[model samples]
Target chain A: MKHNSYFDGKVQSLELHTENGVATVGVITPGQYTFGTSTQEKMVITAGSLRVKLPDQDWQTVMSGEFFVVDKNVSFVVEAEQDVAYLCYYF
Target chain B: MKHNSYFDGKVQSLELHTENGVATVGVITPGQYTFGTSTQEKMVITAGSLRVKLPDQDWQTVMSGEFFVVDKNVSFVVEAEQDVAYLCYYF
Candidate 1:
């Protein structure tokens, strides 16, 4: 039931499935990246600060307990200031 | 930008994406369910208790912080005794 998928030295993507939609949780370290092309997606900051670079938009800062929905199919990069852990739920 | 996707009236599917694999988080109420046909999936119980009925397997009980890996491509049912909140991460 419980498995430890470590992202200490690498980048990984989490794909989730259900009857409604999908959700993904990404773990980003400093200088690491996670990309997406969804026009509208929900992101939750579980831990740490994440620097989100959206297409045609300036870099935005997302903190813990805060989330954002990308209204456009924008390519974004997630960078961690320290050690960032996030849960990106795509419906 | 945090949006609350409530499942008080229905069931939802969470689809996650990354370079590694997909992870899904399902929230099941009493008598609700989430199904899958994937062999060898990692599941994490964030909260509540989930009763799992696997193929060719006996009924199993999964509680908070306890997860199991279904090593065979089997259909399973998740039922809650009270109210169960779980995070199923597949990678």
Candidate 2:
């Protein structure tokens, strides 16, 4: 298993293998962070909600059970008013 | 934000405030771990699954979206075949 800590540990994730591909379960604290993807990413919210702003897109709220996709080599901003739990898949 | 690492960092959690109370979102590695609680806990599986052995009870599998409760001052054993994501409410 791989453990990742980002933004001075405000965001953390654990790497896992899933049938679809490699995935990560992570938590984001109450703050905003920018992420750049190396592969096409599908991010699913499992707890709380995240306000996201993708490149060339308006900010949106992704609630629990909702998901968003980001193209490879793109950057996105995610804001968490409260703690948010998420699972992200890389393809 | 509070971060907890247990079992030499095989399991990790982040503290959060919920409507019900204080809670933690965490991930369990693929192994068996023993946990002791200082407060009553309701653990909800959010991803993958957990096989749990509560005090004086037989082992049971709790899948995603399912929950199990444990009283305060008790100990339990949990096993994960894959990385399992969970939210635990403490009261």
Per-candidate TM equals 0.45, 0.88
| B-chain TM-score for every candidate | 0.68, 0.98
Task: Report per-candidate DockQ.
Answer: 0.05, 0.43
The best candidate by DockQ is 2
Positional deviation of residue A49's Cα in model 2 after best superposition, in angstroms:
1.6
Best by lDDT: 2
Model 2 spans with C-alpha error above 4 angstroms = none
Tens digit of lDDT per residue, candidate 2, span A1-91? Answer: 5778899988987777766778887888889999999999999987789999999999999998899999999999999998888888899
**Per-candidate local distance difference test:** 0.57, 0.88
Task: Give lDDT tens digits, candidate 1, residues A23-42.
Answer: 55445556746565654787
- Chain A TM-score per model, please list them: 0.69, 0.99
